[model samples]
Target: MEVGGSPTWSEPNGPPSPDLTSHAELPEKLRPKNIFEIPVWMGEPDRFCGLVVEWNNEPVHVLPFQKGYMIFGRDPAVSNTFVGHPSVSRQHAAIVWSREDRLAYLIDLESENGTYIDDIQIPLNEPVKLLPGHRISFASCFRRYVFIDQYDRVVKELRKSRPTVRVRHILVKHAESGRPSSWRGETITRTRDEARAQIQSYRRQILEKQEDFGRIASEVSDCTSAKRGGDLGPIFPGQNKAAFEEIAFRLNVGEVSEPVETLSGFHIILREG
Candidate 1:
């Protein structure tokens, strides 16, 4: 970034932080002015463009600026916003555009499996500076990435498919309890708000022990489908409610849905296909 011909970066609200550039010499007239403030438009699409993190032999993720923060993770229920990928932590990492300074920061949310920027594991809760093009990795060593600031280039190169997936779920009923119950023994009556909170909690538990969904569902799910290990079969249109269909269709293969509520009750859905 440049301000008044001077190299620029986000500062900690003090003196202009040291120049991040160590490249070729610049003309005196093009030299940076001290303590320059960045405008709100700095992160706008017309200004800094956006990023595409290429991994798995292709551009797997494209995040546009001015779209608020871009959250990347594996748990669909935990990080209910933005892109979701397999094997990545539910609350993995985020690219935040600082409201205070019009600059971007990548902050890790302290996931079970860590997030990496250029092979260095990001520490929990710390904000790392994001340059124009940097790499980020989630959950594995082979999954390398190249984050580019060019927007149109990535969109043109994007070759992703939106294939549907098969699914199953563990329905932990709250209608009879008047509040959500996870382990099937709570008799205490609670409100809808409490039910929602309990459902979110259950979603977290389900995500962490994903492989045990069927076994756990058979032991815990209130629905009769639990007898068949919670299998819902191929989701056909009109078989389920519109809300459930909307979220079910968006799930990546092998990803699980967060606690979802409907006339039936709170649900923990898994995309088997």
Candidate 2:
């Protein structure tokens, strides 16, 4: 397997070592993993002028009429009411509540410069639910999108509606013979010296073909694998070329190794173990 960051491949003077295995192999349990958590009102905009609350939440009062009216006011018992404020000239930022239902609400700050959600300008003193994946812009400033979970809570929800395994991989080449191998079920070196050299060489090759790999793989990889742009899978210790296997096993999951060289060419190794 390739080691080091250069294009040249050099075999170390040693035989391969024993294989290694990961401690955990099963997927995580299907539960709320708290993918998104932030303090309440942490992302609120400065000079705020709008308010957003779910129907179940208690009615909120907007004091002094910055740019909108309060819900359940004195005169009219309107469920959703809007009143324009002359002093609130700037368009207030939009607050988004992301949920499984894909519901979003936008409140326009009574401003000369209007508020646009997904490019559609909203009327002053009106509240509109933003469309899915819609962009919310106020006076041209982009406000952060607030994601709400299925329970109607204001926490960033994990998009686990659809889940799939995310795999990363590497291909190894023999340094002396220039033969290409899939690198799955093979032995690798664990020595630091050997791995260092192999990784350097592979890194160089990857840098050279980085653009090509992104483009060519999109067109040439097998249908089953092409969707990932030719990503094969994960490579672990003793699972790939000897030089690469050593370093690949040491990395944490989601860590990508620098390029290394083997007899085959250059390779970029990603740790998904």
Clashing pairs in 1: 6-32
lDDT of 1 by residue, 124-237 (tens): 655565665677777663555455554334333432323345888876555433123444455435555665776676667777775477876687676667788888877643
TM for every model, in the order presented, reads 0.35, 0.23
Q: What local lDDT score does residue 44 receive in model 2, on the 0 to 100 scale?
A: 22
Could you tell me the C-alpha RMSD of candidate 2 in Å? 26.5
Per-residue lDDT of candidate 2, residues 177-244 (tens digit): 22222234343333434444554654554556554443343442222344565466643222234455
Off by over 4 Å in 1: 1-48, 80-86, 141-145, 150-273
- Candidate 2 lDDT: 0.36
Give the clash count for each candidate: 1, 30
